[model samples]
Target chain A: MNAHHLRRGALFLWTALLLAFIFAPIVSTIIFSFNADRFPSLPWAGFSVRWYEAVFADATILRGLINSLIVAGATAIVASFLGFAAAYVDYRYRFLGKVVYTALIALPPAVPVVILGIAMLTFEGRLGLSGTLTGVAVGHIVLAVPFAMALVRMRLADLDPDIERAAWNLGATPWAAVSGVVIPFCLPAILASIFLTAAVSFDEFMIAWFVSGVNETLPVRVLAMLQGQVSPKINAIGAIVFVVSMSLVVIAQVLIGNRADRSSKRT
Target chain B: MAFWAIPPILWQFAFFVVPLGFLVAMTFWSVRSFRLTPDMTLANWMFILKAGFFRSAYIYTFKLALLTALIASLSAFPAAYTLAFRLQPRTRRFLIFMLVVPFFTSYPVRIYSTQIFFSPEGIINAMIAPLGLGPVSVLDTPTGTVVGYLVLTLPLVLLLQTFALMNTPRDLIEAAHNLGCGRFRTILTVIVPTARVGLVLAATFAFVLSFGDYVAPLYLGGSNPPTLSILIADQVKSGNNWPRASVVAVTMILTLIVVMTAMLALAYGGRKKGRG
Candidate 1:
């Protein structure tokens, strides 16, 4: 082959291998979830719905899932409300300590979650709120707020100020202008942020590990299970979680992408 | 607007900022058999400095963090390059989407899956069984820990790199190619130089994520003494050494700040150069 043809062939081969490496473990887990064998490894003992049936039968995994859903739902609601407010002020007012506020919001994700967990442990101890679901929710709020804020802030930056100005000029109050006009305009961004926040809170481990007392979230339960022993059932659990999380993220991406495209077209 | 801002500000202050300040303060307080005292002391910081075990833990953790960042970024580059430039636009989007799917899954679940793949009776051993490569012990080894890091951070690096690469002007690449440059030569000369900022940012993200990670090592790094994160946890939970934990916490925060600042400066410099 000529050099150009040879180069193209090499690129194709490399891309295929890269894709395989990325997807192998994922595909393997999915395959094992269907395997009838007790071991997670190969030589599939024929396909069966036994593991999925077993997962549903297990009270612990089901409870963990429900706990995660509640925490993630609560976190999304509280974080998005607070984040929207914070982003609005920062975007419009240019208040004192804006830089500091921005930095603090960004800091949690950057700091080690373990350290944050310990910090929360100490802080909650003083408040006598340690080892409570409230404490875990508080921790989730702290972590999820920054992500929510960043997402909303990006949307706010894209919005035209004239729309709000026009509402004000028409004798609308500031709250009326914002609530009636601005929020509706940024609805897609807000929705995306909620989904993203929920995913993050649901998946969070370290912070939940420290703060969760008698209440175990799905990830915390999974960690406990893995540490105690290797169970093929964990693979079944992992496969279900992977599919659910991936679907949520895909939905979030599609929403955000669609909004961007529409906005660009409008402009 | 002011009314709305008030509640979030108050909530954040109470829950976020105040907690961090309290943690710093708690470090100095005395702990006697798990009960904290109001009396302050410098003994905890001193203990961290003098204790050989903690000192070694800090060194080992730092080394692992550095190696994980370096290795993840290197492996990520090739895949990123392929997605960014080599693939058709439709195919590129599909690949990028596929890469990010892994990240949406729970972090602990991902680590648990990695354990299954690398454990003695796992798939890797199953694949090698016929070759007499009996039961390779991948989990619990430093190498295994690094593999876990790679599995966790690879998607992140890829996503960041793809974002960076998307911003590079197509015309610039075309210009270089028109000048008789080979594809690889064009990538090195035109693409790499332009995309270096993204690479650095991706590396920073990888470093910060891997360094701060406690979960992967906790599950996979069996028998390895606590990483710096685990050490910090130990002090707080088991040892009741809050002050020393504070010192370690402060050290880690400072290290991250330095690295993040350097990455930002590099990105800023690149943007300024591009504009010029």
Candidate 2:
């Protein structure tokens, strides 16, 4: 083959191998969840849903799932609202110390989860919010808000500032202009941020592990189970969490992707 | 506009800034009979710093984080280059989406499942046995820890690299080629220089994440040689040593701030031309 063919073939092979490496753990988790084997190994012991059934039957796991859902939902709403407000403020105004404000908003995700977790744990302990689901939700909201703000901010960057001004000039109040014009323009990003933040909160482990004492989220529960024993049931829990998290992320991606397409077409 | 900004700013101050302040303050406080009493003593910091294990863990964590960043940046480049330059737009987009998917998934699950590939009786050994490469032990070792870090970072590094490389000006590459530069030389002199900021930022991100990651080291490395995160968890779990844990956490935060500032300077500073 020519050098051109060789280069193309090498690139394709590299892509395939990289993808295999990326997905191996996730694929193995899903496969073992369905495998009837007590341990994760090769030579499949036939397919069975018994582990999944075990997951559903467990009281603690069920409670953890419910707790995760609640935390994720609450975190999504609160974080998205705050994130939208933050993004809108950035979009509509230029104030002194804007750089500090932007940097502070972007700082949480960059910090190690261990540090954030302990800080939350210590501070919440003083506030009497420690060991409560509300504490866990609060921690998650802090972590997820930056992500939500980033998404909304990107969308806001595409919006013309004059549209809100036009709405105000047409006798609409500032609040009305925001609700009628700005929010509608940012609706897709807001929805995407909601899902993305929900996924983030749902998959988060360290903060939940620190603050959700006796009210463990699914990921925290998974860790407890993992430390306790190498159970096949953990594989089942992993599969479920993977599905839920991926679904939320996928929904968010689809929304953002669709918005990008529309905006690209407009340009 | 300032009115809309107040709530989020207040929320960040109340939760993020205030909690971090508490962490820093707690490092100076002493724990008495499982109760934390506020004091302005540096005992917690001194105790941890004097402990040999803590010092070793810091060195080990720094080395491992650097190793992860290096390996992830190097290995991800080929795939990232392929995606950015070799693929059709639709295929590239699909691959990019696939990379993004893992970031939002359950990281604990991902780290746990990696055990299957690292164990002596695991898939990696099984695959290599046919080639007469005897079953090698990787699980619970530094090698395994690095693998776990890679699993966390490689995809992210690849995505960032791809985005950065995609932004490389096409005309610059063509101009290099027309000047009789070889393909590799073109990449080195043209593409690499142009995408230096994004590339450096991507590797810095890899370093930052690997430095702070808790799951990979704990699960895959078995916490044998504890990282700072593992040490923090141990301190917190053992007899309510929250003060000691805060000391470690604060050390970590300081390390991150220093490293991030240095990396950002490397990425954006030192150049008269505004590239980034």
Candidate 3:
């Protein structure tokens, strides 16, 4: 091959290597969860369903799983709804203090999560809100809301304002216009935000570690257990988390699929 | 319009801004007689700066973030470039989707697994053992932490730069080609210049994420030299030195601001040259 072809081949190789690097750990975590051996290592033992069964059998793991789901579900609903409202306002009405609005939305991602975690702990002490699902959910909403708003904002920008205007001109009430116009238009992105935020809340550990109190989320439990010893059981839990989040992404993708067409119709 | 903004603004102020303000204030106040006091002083900040361990932790954290960003951006560029320019559109979307799947999973879990694999008798060592490259453990090493951060931030940075490259108008690239530029020459001149600011933003983001991450360092960083995040957590959890922890947190945040400002300036400078 000439230099150009050779360069092309190297590029393909690099991409393949990156793909392997990205997928390997998760793939191994899932594949080895079914390992018959107690330890996660080479010399493939016979595949067994025992590990998946073990995850369900353990009470702490099961409870942690439930707690995680609760936090994630609550975060998705609360964050997405509030975020949609915020994003809609930002998109629709550009005001003089919009710079301040932009700065506030950008805060969570800019600050290190550890600071947020510890800050909330002390701050909650003052409010007497420390160590509860409500507190933890609020913390997650703080982290996730910006992202949710960003998503809905993108979708809203794509949607034709004329459609909403047309509805208003035809004698629709405010609620009626939202239900008949904005809801259908923003449905996919709103759903995407819900799943997306759910994924973030589900995987979140650092902030949740502080605010969670006695009830540990799944990631916290895994971290706590791993601090003591390495168990294939932890791997099993990790596998399940990987699978669940992957499914959530697929669901989000399905929701977001027709968005290009939505935008394409705008121009 | 004001009403539309009220709910989120109120929520952020009630939860986010107030807490952050408290954290900032906490940094100036020092403990007295083992009780939380309102005696505002820079003594906590002075103590943190003077301490050898805290200083080293800061250095290690910044170094590791830089290293991870370097690794991530270097690796991400090739993949992102290929995806943007080489692959068929259908294949490109599928690959991008595949790339994104890892990030949706639990990040800490992935780091923990990286730790597991880097252990002495870990799977990686076991595989390499027969090849006489036996027992390669990087667990707790600065290198190991970088590896963990690399995996965590790589996907994010890759997605970012891939979009950056995608957003670079194709006609500009064609124009460069028509001007007698070879493919590599075209990439160096046309593609990179257009994507410079975005690529810089992506790298800086990767750097920030890596530096702020306590999880990877907790597991992958060896017992002695912990990163800033790990050190801050230890101070808060074990030392109960909330004031000192706040100082450290403030320092890290400031350092992050400096790093970001520098990167943004660099990206902007490059953009000026591109425009010229």
Give me the candidate number with maximum DockQ.
Answer: 2
Q: Score the docking of each candidate (DockQ).
A: 0.62, 0.78, 0.75
TM-score of every model versus the real structure:
0.93, 0.97, 0.95
In terms of lDDT, the poorest run of 10 residues in model 1 chain A is A14-23
lDDT by residue for model 2 over A172-263, one digit each (tens)? 99999999999998999999999999999999999999998888889999988777667889888988988898898889988998999999
Which stretches of candidate 3 lie above 4 Å from their native place? Answer: A261-267
Task: Kindly report the interface RMSD of candidate 2, rounded to 1 decimal.
Answer: 1.2
Better of 1 and 3 by lDDT: 3
Badly placed stretches (over 4 Å) of model 2 are: A1-4, B273-276
Residue A42, candidate 3: alpha-carbon lDDT: 78
lDDT for B11 in candidate 1 is: 75
Docking level of model 2:
medium
Candidate 3 lDDT over B161-203, as tens digits, reads: 9999999999999998999998888988888888988899999
> Highest TM-score, which number?
2
On residues A1-267, what C-alpha lDDT tens digit does candidate 1 reach at each position?
A: 598788778766766775666677677777888888877776678997788898899998898889888888999889988888878877777767878876766567777788788888778877887777678888998888888888888889987888889999999999899899879877887888888888888888888888786688888888888877667677788788887777667777887898889889988
Best by lDDT: 2
Error of 2 at B121 (Å): 2.1
